[model samples]
Target: MSSKDYYPMETKGSPKSYSPHKNGNLMDKSSSEQTEKFLPVIEPGLDSLNKNPEDVDFIPVDHTPPDRYRLVFFIMVVHGIGILMPWNMLINAKQYFEEYKLGKNETEVVELKGKFMFYLGIFSQVPNFVMSGINTFCQCGGQASPRRIIISISIMIVVFITTVILAMVDSSDWSVEFFWITMMTAVILNMATGVYQNSTFGLAAILPMKYTNAIVLGTNFSGVFIAVINIICIISAPDPRTQAIYYFVCAIAVLLIAFDAYFLLPLTKFYQHHRAMVRRQQNTSGPSRSFQETCALFGQVLKKIWVQALCVWFIFFVTLTIFPGIWSNVTKKDFPIENKYWTAIFCFLSFNVFAFLGNIVSEWKKIPGPRFVWIPVLLRGLFIPFFLFCRFEVENKVRTFPILIDNDYVYIVGGVLLAFTSGYYSSLTMMYGPKLVEPEVAGIAGMIMAFCLVMGITTGVNFSLAVASMAIQ
Candidate 1:
């Protein structure tokens, strides 16, 4: 009954324990089961012997199912487009909102034109930031799910439909009221967008890194898609109401496609397999954590990815601060193009096209990894001044600062650089985010990165107000 009685210490390394049939003794040959029973239990990592599978410090063989025909990738991209369609549509329809909708009367036009872009930025991104943070917490608690994505998309659809209806009614008589109504819609649409965006990021995080980048690609592409449409509208010269209708219709169509694509995800073996893996890990890790526990997990994940997360935030912060708020209003200076197309081409079209290209480039290769990614991202702050001094046509506000970069080509180049870096680094940071943490909490990391993204935009937009004021005063 002694510890060494069954197997003496000398037998620990004995060949008999491994193969009693050694030396070809047929009578002494041990059966496979007998040999297996005597074989020593190899403890790879004694500390992990009692720990959960997820707690083990090792990468499991990736048994993830192949994304058939890249269906899952396309779905994430569609969700990306869907989540941003409302905002992009509204932003691209700058003329409609500023000129026709809010510019009905000269007084209202004067009062609103200078302030509308800032208002739009504030209304849209503030709610987006708040909701994304709240949604991230919900994700930690397991309350955020695909169902929330469905509900969020549905709410956005309804909001777009309402916008379309309002577009037809001609609220020119009530421009001020219409302005407030439009801002209200922006708030509502983006609230849903926050949840939708955060959930989509979390969902995509469950898959490969490229899948999450697909969402970033789709977001940038959404802008490109709308910008192309806007260009066409400008050339074709559609009436404001008709053009507004066209923009919302395209947005709704994209949303519908994304909504349809979402259902297909669960049916796919690839998606189901990933979902199962996550669920299994969660179960094996013991029941879901309490609120405090979830918060602790969130902090842990944030600590792991805070650098990349902040990179994601600052990237957007720099982008939003100068983009439509400052860039959209920029003109060709003393070398005016004799048409109103300069801002559209040099600003909207250029930024979107190059940004989309940047996303594609990021997908092709990640430069500098996560640690040094913040370097290029931080250097992007120079773009704020580059755009600030560009020719802006803010009504009634005189430029207090001299135009440092007077040439249109330099300005265009800056726009392209700023936009491309935004897309490229945004993609890099986001893709780096979930990967920086443990696999079980990758989804939470994705949500946190998403919140950081919104936080950046919110901060950038608010900061833009001061920047704009300083530029004009």
Candidate 2:
């Protein structure tokens, strides 16, 4: 038979002859079987870009990057510095307030501090809630364009700087109303920071998962630096007024961070570009889901995973907020070391150092062992109860060993455990939560966790006050 008249096999059988022009095109007898072989395998939707094997346009994803992981490190550092100043300032604020008032004794001092912090927690959340709402909208709407993101971040930084300056300027003539206003401003600024943080995390979620570790490590180190700088401020300040001055100096550090962000944002476009590219590749080759669909997927993920993250956040803030207040008051009241401020400062710095080390170990080990993180956290939880027990030993005013040494040891031990657990928990939570969530929703997941943290702080302070009041009665 002529080649033009030869028909393709529909089954693996003898060839038949058919006229291409008159009897329609020649059918492949074997081709139907071949087609049947692949009939059960469905091609993913166009949005997913899972091309058929016959398609020639399909290209394997390019995972190789031109730049090294240096950008990851740089971004992480920027993130860390941004958070460090705020956290340290908040932690040290109690000491400054106490010095200003000339308060004596743990009971009197801690009560006042606890009340102030409780109010601060409630007041400060206003900005955070606003920021979170805005962030939730932006992430869901798929409006996270670079221009929009950068502008949002810049506004947040400006708010932070402006609020800090206002607080500093008004410090000399501070009143309760002014204090409330300052706290409100600080909270909004912090909320703005949270917005930027969520945006960044959303951007990260779409990229390869390895960069998450870098972010986690960077945040931990930022906490460390904040602690170290706070210690220096405590050591150098001779009086409450001077301590306020040091805080202003730390504000300068924040100003520097703002400047860094300004300059670095443009230069870091490559990193951003790389992330976008990878995300697109994943979206194209992996699965098909619309923006709305992705958001819905993320919501489900949040509902499932947030419970554990919330628990972690609650435990963290309880120990973090309450104990620091108690430790500062107790140290200042009973242990009048020649430089108690320095002792406090060093203890905080040492705590950060231990936290930094913990992060390094976590990064180096790269193990998914839950115990690696949980054991340290559990130990810290245990340490909290221990500290509560020892509160009486210090309260009795007994000279067991030297007063300063005893106080120092207690603070150091507690601080170290707290720092270690905080670093470990943050790392593990970020790492594990994503595994169980849709990548698109990781930003909101983080936001929810942040919300839990603030809530925890609020509850912990309230609990502390209630306990203190009960003890007095």
Candidate 3:
């Protein structure tokens, strides 16, 4: 039939055409009998995209330029860097901040170094808790534009300027207020990291599962990148102030690259084709469902897939609670050779590297990461005690808990496991969560998973103080 003469088989309630599944889906009835005109099982509201269900706009798998797998990977890596790099650089570049912003001379900074480290840990997580709620609202309201990158870039530029100022000025000569302003600006930018991260994951969710994997991998890459920079600077840089400047210059440059990637992403044929189709339907199909409608749309799917949500949350919760915050405090030099800041940065690097491996490892192992993951997630709490025993409050080095491992190698091993399992299982949870429902709401499922992961980060950050306290005790 011509387009104008079409009866559009997608219409519901034709008794002869469809067999209603107990779930809300409808399947073609006649396939079993013979040559039947039955349509494939799909979500009820999804038919609005096409008057005929048979011609669903498939987002052709085009791994070309802009939307190429590597480009997607790069964008996500930049996205990941945006999420964690600011906070980490600030916290890890502790000596520089202490001397420059806090107005401590080298002698005083050395004397109170442990206190600074401890406080930076606490300061970083505070924003994670605050931003999660704001992000949920941002996601639900929907970003009509790529404002996430805009906000991030603008904030980052201001932060970059402040860092340059802090780098050049003598802290003692500069007003204490200026130093506080700089410190607060970094914290604020780090706090706002999730805004862009949430937007990045949401964009990736609308793409294929491989794209989603790319986003996750990118995040780990951020950690690895920051760790490497800090390690190199610690070993090579003569002045702490210069090291801080290097970190800021790199961070600012990275923000520009992320903006470029974000800008280029939509130009790809892969992105263009999908987006054009979606936009066309949205224009002709009346207003899309409200956030409440979406919530209701996938409420049942979410119930069935609660484990996926929990796994996402717990994996991150376990990670945030122990890593960077508590883990960075453990002192270590080069494994066999003594090197400055190698212990903290290396531990951080181990987590990110292993996590990246875990994400990719899914290709070889046919392991369903979501299955039986909660058990190990529950056991991860035990990592706190193990890592605590290896940590010291002493200015030089001293183990607090002597019950188990006193060796730095123990910390390295524990960090590896912590990073690896987190990467592996979180990847699996995200991959499988979208399959819990019909393909139409698969995007919603993925978005929900990302939201829960953000929630997990917030929860972990909030729990960090308690975990840190209990670990030290």
Report lDDT (CA) for all predictions.
0.78, 0.49, 0.62
| lDDT of candidate 2 over 39-134, digit per residue (tens) | 111122222343433341222223333446566556655654554455456655655654453244455444444456445544554455456456
- Which segments of model 1 are wrong by more than 4 Å? 1-62, 140-143, 334-338
Candidate 2: clashing residue pairs, number = 9
Off by over 4 Å in 2: 1-61, 66-69, 101-114, 125-130, 141-174, 207-210, 234-239, 252-274, 277-295, 303-311, 321-323, 332-336, 366-380, 392-411, 437-473
When sorted by TM-score, best at the front, the candidate numbers are 1, 3, 2
Give lDDT: candidate 3, residue 382: 82
Per-residue lDDT of model 3, residues 177-280, tens digit only: 55446547756775666566665665666566666777777777777787788778877985888888988888888777886777677545666554433333
Model 2 worst lDDT window (10 residues): 33-42
Worst window of 10 by summed lDDT in candidate 1: 34-43
Q: List the residue pairs that clash in candidate 1.
A: none
**Model 1, residue 245: displacement in angstroms?**
0.7
TM-score of each: 0.85, 0.67, 0.77
Backbone collision count in every prediction? Answer: 0, 9, 0
Model 1's alpha-carbon lDDT is 0.78
Error of 3 at 104 (Å): 2.9
Cα RMSD (angstroms) for every candidate in the order listed:
11.3, 11.8, 6.7
Q: Clashing pairs in model 2?
A: 8-28, 8-29, 9-28, 9-29, 9-30, 10-28, 10-29, 10-30, 11-29
Instruction: Compute the lDDT of residue 133 as modeled in candidate 1.
Output: 88
